[model samples]
Target: MSQGVEFNRLMLEMRSMQADAMVRQKPVASTPEPGAPSFSEMLGQAVGKVNETQQASSQLSTAFEMGTSGVDLTDVMIASQKASVSFQAMTQVRNKLVQAYQDIMQMPV
Candidate 1:
């Protein structure tokens, strides 16, 4: 469904970002590209998005539990699942980042 499509799109974006990072050469100067956001900015934005998703999901669940009109159970469930999936994806990314850092730190000088 739409969720599957969205997830696929997210995965594609991640792959493209990873490839781009790998393909990039070291810059002569410390300054980043004029228009491109820094890695920290991108990471912050992603975290913000996940936080937003979880907050929205929580609000939806609360509305449903309070018997608010026009709040469907299916919609609430879908939001919950989306939030859960996003959180899992973030966790996996964090784990990979940590592992990579450890591997780099353990490298021979």
Candidate 2:
């Protein structure tokens, strides 16, 4: 079905984005180039992206529920799934960050 194909495409897109993020990451000891975003800035941008995705999904669902023309059920479902996956990914990253922080704090001074 076309829905399955679309879902596959979305998953591929997410994987590519993850790869790009990995490529962008820098080592802790390196000095960032001028104008490059710092680690905190990058993290903030990622969170912003997740927020935007969720908002877009909400708007799409609302439009579909309101009987707006050109709103497809499949599209709404896909958007909702994308939002859910992105939120879960963000939550995992947050958990990892918290764990790292706790580990660092427990280090011998």
Candidate 3:
């Protein structure tokens, strides 16, 4: 559908804008507090949230298929779409990270 295409384009544009902003951001190196989460920890948490969203969507779809009461078609559809979008976004992030890693590896010391 055209709407879906448009939505995807918009999402990609937003992601590019975000990446650009991050590229232009100034780094402030400060010592981490003893109890603070590291960068990897935050990334893992984000991935976990994406996984949770997909799992929730799967559960809702299963419930609807089983004719569970109070599970509206609209809600199921929305959940599925949300899960799909999140998964796609996560995939894009992974791709970008891989590309960055490759770029870094190619750089000469």
Candidate 4:
């Protein structure tokens, strides 16, 4: 078969494997009571991920600036781009959450 066809087949196989793994994964059900920290916990986790991504980007930038021998420019660029995308996504989520909160607050009691 052609190289493109082989690559497509490989990608299909990888996706199938990923789907199977996801299907077999156990679900974690939360039993938090009302007024608990479900929202805070999710927000904290998202913020933590964003912070980690930002730190990775900062390190990559520093390595690039310091002319580190082991750091490739392409890798640094990719890391920075990934961090930027994640930051943008987080900002969008925050905006939507704020809008939802405002809408709920405006509803008649």
Best by TM-score: 2
> Looking at model 1, which ten-residue stretch has the lowest summed lDDT?
23-32
Cα-based lDDT at residue 109, candidate 1:
100
State the lDDT of candidate 2 residue by residue for 1-109, as single tens digits. Answer: 6657756876786688678778877888988778777778878988998899999999999999999999999899988988887799889999999999999999999
Global lDDT of model 2? 0.86
TM-score of 3: 0.72
TM-score of each: 0.78, 0.81, 0.72, 0.66
Give the higher-lDDT candidate: 2 or 4.
Answer: 2
lDDT string for model 1 (1-109, tens) is 7667766876786688678766653576766667776677777877888899899999999999999999999888878888898789889988999999999999999
Off by over 4 Å in 4: 1-37
In candidate 2, stretches whose alpha carbon ends up further than 4 angstroms from where it belongs are: 1-29
Cα-based lDDT for every prediction: 0.83, 0.86, 0.76, 0.71
- Cα lDDT tens digits, model 4, 1-109, are 3434534654575467447556544446845456544556756876787789789989989988999899987777767766676688679878998999999999999
Top-lDDT structure, candidate number: 2
Clashing pairs in 3: none
Q: Where does the lowest 10-residue lDDT sum fall in candidate 4?
A: 1-10
Candidate number that wins on lDDT, 3 or 4: 3
Model 3 per-residue lDDT tens digits across residues 1-109: 5447645864785577567556544456856557656667756876887798789989999999999999988778877887787778879888999999999999999
Query: Ten consecutive residues with minimal summed lDDT in candidate 3?
Result: 17-26
lDDT of 4: 0.71
